[model samples]
Target: MLIKGYDDGPLVAGESLLPRPGFWSNYLMAICGNEPGASYVPEWFGDDGADADDLSEVLFDPERWPVFRAPAQGGPGVVVIYRNLLGDYGIDYLLTHPGRSHAQHVASWEGDLSGTGLSWDELIRIADTPATGEGVKDSAARLLLVLPLLTDPDLPDTAPARLTAALSEAGAPQDTASTTAEHLLAQLTRRSQHDPTWESPLSGA
Candidate 1:
């Protein structure tokens, strides 16, 4: 019989063995500092028999999202772009309390961002730009950077230009101007219905 966590069969008539967890076994791998190819299960999952309960805790835990601190003076932040149980890509974020270890959810693709002082359009703009020496600012930025690349490949070249313009027009006021030009390469490829003439950031393009 097949079980959720057991992929391998019994070793002997009375002896049983647990299947090793795969690279994609759980969401914690996305940020838990564990390398992807490791065969062992994460300690967070508990013993082999507790797999079900461990999974439940991972899915329901309020602090499940991984946190990344800013390099300079900014507070801690988290940017997670993960596939949900439904196999759809989703994004989430958290802002840490000043001088404290705790943080709170500030944004998600499916929820409100009113508390973040950022808008979806501004996020899309930032995602389009190439990473600076500072790197990506947050999880929302990372999601916007990747989502369009995975979109339908048949979109027209003009689509990205138009989308960029629209997003820019919709963007909120900022303290300073962005140095990079808006990214519309994915849109351009999709709209043109062809592969990029230049190299792509995605692997195996």
Candidate 2:
């Protein structure tokens, strides 16, 4: 039950609550901002609860793809595509087909990306450790957030290189290894924002 918002990542999750109207409004604003003269068209929603099949249909269909491809506004430039199903296909579909005539990337908090190859639970535990505190926690959380998006198998094994690269590019403070840990934790706690390219940045830092 993840409802990612354009204004902020993971607007809501782990609940059956409907997404706030303001969130949708923000998304609409972002779309219009990107395409100045684009007209608003009412989309056909499912009568029954939305399932993966319906969700997949929306993503795969050429007409509907534009809605999800809109660039994120008011935060990171990336678009926020909510996948209620949290399935592999949702992620794979975006990576496979990102629509056309746009240079924006869809950055999402996916999988687990803390430690060399730790599980989500393990990553959380590490982040929650008293010694880790906010800085390290935020770093660890962000890495975990990006874990699911990477196409790497044995994600735990190869994530460090990617994390280090992102940290360096973002000008993350301290040594590469420590900053990577901090970035991952920051993501889980919603203390940071990962750029469209997946570089986690500490907000207000």
Cα RMSD for predicted model 2: 18.5
The lDDT of model 2 is 0.30
Per-residue lDDT tens digits for candidate 2, residues 41-149, read 2121111223323433443343222222212112222222444343431221121112333333334433322211223433323323423111122333343233433
Candidate 1 lDDT trough over 10 residues, lowest sum = 10-19
- What is the C-alpha local distance difference test score of each model? 0.31, 0.30
TM-score of each: 0.25, 0.23
Clashes of 2: 25
Model 2 Cα displacement at 58 (Å)? 28
Which candidate tops lDDT? 1
Stretches off by above 4 angstroms in model 2 are: 1-78, 81-153, 156-158, 176-205
Count of clashing residue pairs in every prediction? 6, 25
